[model samples]
Target: MEYTLSPSVTIINNRQVLVSSSSPSPANDRRRRRRRRRSNGILHFPFVFSGLSLRFRSRAVVVAGAGSYGGYGSGGGSYCEFSCLNTPIEPATPAGRYLSSVLLNERKLFHDAVAETLEKLVKEVDEAYARKALTVDSSEAALHRRIAELKQQECKTSVEDVMYMLIFYKFSELRVHLVPPLSKCIYNNRLEILPSKDWELESIHSFEILEMIKEYLTFVIGWRSDFSVTESWATTKIKQANLCHIYTTSILFGYFLKSTTLRHQLEMSLADPIDDIIMNAYICRRKNLVFGHTHNKIPTSPFDGKRERENLVSYLTGFTSDSLAKCAQPNSKEALNLITKYSFALFGDVGSDKMISTSFATLKRLVLEAVAFGSFLWDSEEYVKTVYNLEEIN
Candidate 1:
């Protein structure tokens, strides 16, 4: 017979089974009862809420015979229900946490201590160098000795020791001029301070050296390229221009060598050459009048007429400090005003041979005047500025 099972209930051949039942006595009844029991056992019924009758040989089996039924019985029921266990267990404390914090604090303190020690060492070194307790060569020798001692102590050279050595060395080199035999002192100081193996010198000429000093002077005075006549030419029209570029490059090379005295000397030499170039260019620009000749030929002479001569004199006077104040500030305002005034003075005035000749003479005079003025200015302002700047740096 077919059987269907439901939650907490069992059916055999569409009939419900009682959990408790007594055994049937007749052979037919016993056989029928055994068949029913076998069918019920196949259903595997669980505990039920309500009492249900189990048919055996057309008789009802009650709860009292549940144990005897064997398959569906009250004796098989559990006394207590089970439940699930679900809670998290706490982990044991880690041993490394406290140690790690202490280590971090110690490292920070060590870094701070090292930094303070370095600063003190630097200050002591600078004071010693200043007082001549350490000569440039001696200072360098000391550094080498110290480095060697540190290497022996630690069995290896550290980046920190190297850096400290470099700082002391640089400060000494920078202040070389303050010591005696300035050039030698500076050179020695630089050699001591800089890494010994990495220095190079450029090939240079004397004229070029002179020109460089002049340009350096102008640069310090705040002369803008746009305001100068040299900027207008594609080529360096004057020899001083070429010289200046060369000298400036050379001086820069000396700076790399850490030779303060050599650098100063180069700068000092430039004063005369720079003055001459600036003056000549200024005068040439002032007489640059485009004369419209009757023959349609360009006039060779720049200053021809009485009016041009008067104009030239007036232009020169206007460049004076008092006159420049009517225009702008510092000395640059006067210089710029002079450049502008002269630039416009000769614009498009065409005239006769006599006028052209006069203009040419005026141009020559202006050039000569500029040269003299430049020479004096270079020796005075440019020289002072360079020396002062170097002093400040040291």
Candidate 2:
């Protein structure tokens, strides 16, 4: 398929979402044309919208003019569509016109930007596996080969995808989910996502994971103009744009973890039932997903490696979110882009400087949801690619 990028269009989730008023203001029209503002791969909508989103995400991946992804089966129920959409899609304070604006060539920009960031990060990670490799190319090849040829067996996937998963393994080391006693019903007699008040934060990643987080903190957050990140990131007012950046990257982080964990499980599952004990041990739980008051609807973390595969498979077979279908598909490319780009729209104008001074406790839920969002995206992108051309299809 062939597509064109237009400076006049707003591309959300890889689909063009054109927003225009039925009528144009004579005063505004009379104004002289000016150069469009530079965009940082984030779009800003100035007017009121019921939340104008151009992407569609349901229970499973659907590849139409949009795309559909096949979900994995976990012997469990489905999650609420876009349960990961923790915030509204409006600007923080609103500033910029939609037309006459362009994204910073996110497709090519993403790869180059990540390569530059990873250049500084690769040194801190344990490269005993790569024989002291320092650049992304050498380290990526060695790491991808290791995952593909585990236990003397082979699996096939793009080296780029594998590289992303491996790069993130060390850069961050945290995940979030709600504690047990997930109540399915509330005073309104409807299913609602539990608030951050009930969240449980865990930092039990491997020694390597923690070290990577440290390296990233120093490289990325150690010198920010907005706020500071100490050994413990204290509760302070933070820039919405920065939070949006973190939000987008966290999704990629979890998505990579989910993908790597699933591939690793495929290799280990065939080796020995005894090996399962260590690899498949419980990780963390994601508070995203809607349950039918059933005991098994809760989803296991992708890191768990024991049930995410099964959970994803079940979604393919028959899991669904009817009324919410258009709003979710946590496992699809559209959903991935939808959630990732959401950061650009959440506060102020596109890349607005306004800060979301909300309590740290309240924002934690959104942060965790972003990670869980990526995990599901991996499942969607992973399974959908088997039948669809896949690879973000941009």
My TM-score estimates for the predictions, one after another, are 0.13, 0.31
lDDT scores in order = 0.24, 0.32
Worst 10 residues of 1 by lDDT: 82-91
Instruction: Give the C-alpha miss distance for residue 286 in model 2, angstroms.
Output: 19
Off by over 4 Å in 2: 1-194, 197-235, 272-336, 386-388, 391-394
Taking the tens digit of each residue's C-alpha lDDT, what string does model 2 give over 263-349?
444443434445444343322112111111222122333344553343222222242223122322234443444454343333223
Q: Residue by residue across 258-295, what tens digits does model 1's lDDT show? A: 22222233333334453454445433432321110111
RMSD of each: 51.4, 23.7
Query: In candidate 1, how many Å is residue 370 off?
Result: 2.5
